[model samples]
Target chain A: MSARDAVLGAVKAALGRSRPADPADPAAVAAEALALLADPDAVRPALPGTDAAVAFAARVVSPKVGATLDRVEALADLPGAVRRYLDGQGLPHLLALQPDPALQGLDWAGFELRDAALPDEAAAFGLARWGIAETGSLVFHSGPDTAVLGHFLPLHHIAAVRASTILPHLEDYAAVCGAAPRNANLITGASGTTDIEGSYVRGAHGPRFLHVLLVAD
Target chain B: MGTVFKRDVARALSDATLKTAIDRTTVTAERKRAAALTDYPQFAAARERGTRIKDHVVAHLDHYLLEFERNATASGATVHWAADSEEACRIVLGICRGAGARRVTRSKSMLGEEIGLPHALEAAGIERVETDLAEHIVQLAGETPSHIIWPALHKTREQVSALFKASHRDPHKTEDVEAMVESARRELRDRFLSAEVGISGANFLVADSGAVCTVTNEGNAELTTTPPRVHIVTAGIEKLVPSLAHAFVLLRLLVRSATGADLTQYTTFHCGPKRPGDLDGPQEFHIVLVDNGRSRMLADAGLREMLRCIRCGACMNHCVVYRQIGGHAYGATYPGPMGAVLTPALQGAEKARDLPHACTLNGRCQEVCPVGIPLPALLRGWRDRSWKDGLVPQSVRSGLWLWRFAAERPRLYHLGTAAAVRAMRLFRRGGWIGRMPLAGAWTRYRDFPAPAGRTFMEQLRDRERGR
Candidate 1:
């Protein structure tokens, strides 16, 4: 038997069945599993947040959030916010930007822009498709526009997400993240680890700094 | 069997470093767990939902496993199945050889450890570097992971600093934690950027969309999978949830129960190799699902609940036996109450009979268990099986037999206990027995209370006579 057959057959045997789909009086195991997939709305925890944007902003900028945030009135205002955040953190304004359309049509007179973030690059910019409020997570979908390296390679990651795209919870993103994203990253905060004897370290492997730009428009 | 474990634990008990490290992590984790649950009152409900989802998936694993394979293939990823650990190692080795991978970068994987993947790689002449900070420390020290979450937290800071200085060959080394972390980051960055293959363990597999999800606080997993030419995910068949929604529900329970965090710093899902025009991701994506005795576990209804483990390390953090002796004493891939039950089921009740007997049946592990595994009951079940299989120690078996013989005879039991109570008084020193013959092990650490002059049965009889 194929390894798949042998393995699944083992399960079938465990469940007291001879095959995946049997015509026994009891419901076939395959059919029962398919029935579960039909219903996507599983039980969700009762988190206290009715308004998505408010909860998201509060969480992203919370005192112990390990990340910084800036709320821009429009998508066009994101450049100014990023500039201000860079200036505030004493980081260089030069950034390797993901070649995304959502990032175009912006005035970039002062800042030097480059392609996908280099391994030792100080900062990188990317656009997020969705933001989750419950944990203040940014959902990055890899495609022609978004460079997966921009999410990890740089020391600082500036992710921009529209406030209107902020979902109240992670389960809500499942409905929005339909079949398009072959690769999706739900980053809750900056890369960190308490592995060294429970002492918190901000940058363990990836970006040490995660700054989220909430585009109000 | 008892002699081996007794030796291992005897060494662990005397190791001052191990005791200090265990006390720190367990106490901090328990405190954080309480605080996180307090902030989020819905944790109880989320845990219940997570357990129910796992139960449903385990019951119908055959369908979901096939569904995961089909959907993953549809997304341009290859899915391989392994009936056991050897086949799983061979498949991973074959992938690396086919890719001509000289060097590989890896995130921490419990399944990888279970299958002895590191040894396989070493034997096949492939060099692999562990990217997780804790895992990297353990690798340099040439030891298996003790704790699941804090893989190498058992080592002291001085030990970690020394390990780095020796491994990295740095002359200007200090005992500072931050400097050590920076050293690892700098040392591993080139490997992450250069490795041909990156192997990671899946935290959960979404059967609905075939997303191999990995949850980690460190960004090592992200960097490991992103820059490599090939990304191979090694996961157990039991790590499946029905959909992304169900996954989030479990994610809620996992983070809080593990480290008292609201969520993991990073939870990435890879649906396929890469999208049409992705700039930088693995060109090839493959997921190897290993059975490795999980089928045997599923077949046994009594031991089936062991499969619900999310490996958050909560049970170990709160276990009475684990706190006393720590993970290395368990002498298995997994440790603590979960390991106590799972190790025997996977290895055999006879080989690891000492495991089930290690538990004090305190029930603290199950109380803190995110998926609500009845650990005390499971430990009891293993003990019962050990007794039936004659794997229990001869002394314990005979002692129980003697108790049962007396317990069955009420008059003789009263007479025997009355005489035993009088004998116990001989060793009495003031309020407690400092020493007792043939039972010195009982008072080895703690004084045994002096028995009353008469057995309770005799006193009860006198009271009934209205004396």
Candidate 2:
């Protein structure tokens, strides 16, 4: 009678299922989905044996991702690393920081810090929820403190991740993120495009440079 | 569609620029894919897992689609079902109208092209801007995408620069790739910020979490889904996978096969709109599950494997014929070996009668297919069906019949072959035949090599007899 019914009917007839599943019983469907979600380890590939932090550092610095990695011995050392990276790249003094507790209480004297990402911000920094070693991806969950636009809208993106938060594989990252956040971005490297004659050009629509500061305690 | 295939192929072959463009791009893509796979040792295992997951999902598509609907609805998003392109367009337009959307920013979606969404929206007085760089070029040029992943692979830098200069207000544009990309970035940024609705195609629809995952290197998909108030993901029913883990398996294979990257720059999972504490994201999330002709594809057991396509474009990249003729010659939304079988299966065997015959039966497509779809067998099956349906041209049918008659008996076959070789010797000049009867098409391109005086059978028999 409805589009849904017609689609389901056609699918059922094609699949050779004589009768369709009961549409009224959504609980059963949800239960089945929950079962699938509960076991996220199935069909996972065997990852490399490198420790999460080491793998994360190695993968990010690889030519494929082309992301610069900075290691900090403690959270207190983050500002120094960020300052050194900014000075090394000869970037501007101003940077937009995500409104997160981890990024707060940092001694940023010379830099003009803003809470929101401006359209033309030279660099924007955010705290990653987790680091995926397999793909050198930073897992950022969308929340009040972590703005989604700051990750892409800026010319340069700087992310800080705790060494302990790094995981070996995407499956592990998925389990950590739970069912779903509003947005879960696994940003691996600087934004790029091969759209023009298949030439690899970085910073097509997103940040040109991605520098990750891996804070270890 | 029938006449356009040959004409398009002819034009593509003659265009040296197009040939160079395709040859360079496809060679680079193939090399990258090979190198990426070598770096990832688990590619074979992951591909197997991906195949198993897709097979399971397609087998139980009805169940998974329902599960996805329930979960997505529970996550504060609306799910709409469209049995055909008309319904899909109607639902999308209705949603846009309901939300009072005028300017829509769309990420590159093959499904959007399949359903003619842009034309539909334009007809309803909505301005649709394509955000992908290649897609933007094709959009400005008023052309359908030639390749799925790299839509403007057929366009040279000069052509793209010309298109930008003609379309954009920038008078100082150069033919440099980065400058053109920057120009597009600057122009589309305003559209992304100001669009009322964002439309995208999902790489995978996670059934458990009701998340629509889109993979992109340009981050357009992320921007397309982020800023707009209404984010609509239009995906075919076959885009569904059981869970996030399954999605990762396919994701690994997809990037490696498509662009030879270890992983795309951005693989974002949008669960629903924005969550309770989210600062910025779309407030409304909707998914339109489009069937179009997939139900018919599923109805036939032999054709059901077409639904397993991840649209990685590997088949076309590796296809010799596709490399020679390019994608426009296929005269369909999809092209190449996959398109040859899929186009006929989706849009009747009769309509695309010439498509299945365009293949050289190289089996390269199937060899490189990540899903291991026996594409050559499928194309051959389509050819058989076309012949049975009387779609083959009369000349071809009569030629095949003549060959069949001669081949039925070995004695007659040898006799006919000997006679043909004798006749070829008479017409031979410079070790080649300038013209042949009923094969003007073959002779028009290059001289056919004259057959040896004796057939292979006769030579083999004499050699065995120690002559």
Best of the candidates, TM-score: 2
- A-chain TM-score of every model: 0.87, 0.87
Give the number of colliding residue pairs in candidate 1.
0
lDDT digits (tens) for residues B300-410 of candidate 1: 978899899999999998888888888989988899999999898877787788998887888889888989999889889988887787787688879999999999999
DockQ-derived CAPRI band for the predicted complex in model 2: medium
DockQ of 1: 0.57
Which tens-of-lDDT digit does each residue in A1-217 have in candidate 2?
A: 9999999999988988866763334466445544543433443444557688888888899997899988899887877888888889898777888988867777777788998887767889888989998889999988888988999999889998999999998878766777688888999999999988899988888998999999887
DockQ of structure 2? 0.59
DockQ of each: 0.57, 0.59
Off by over 4 Å in 2: A22-49, B171-174, B425-435, B446-450
Question: Alpha-carbon interface RMSD of model 2?
Answer: 2.8
Best by DockQ: 2
Instruction: For candidate 1, give the lDDT of residue B188.
Output: 85
Q: Per-prediction TM-score, please?
A: 0.94, 0.95
- Per-residue error (Å), model 1, residue B464: 6.4
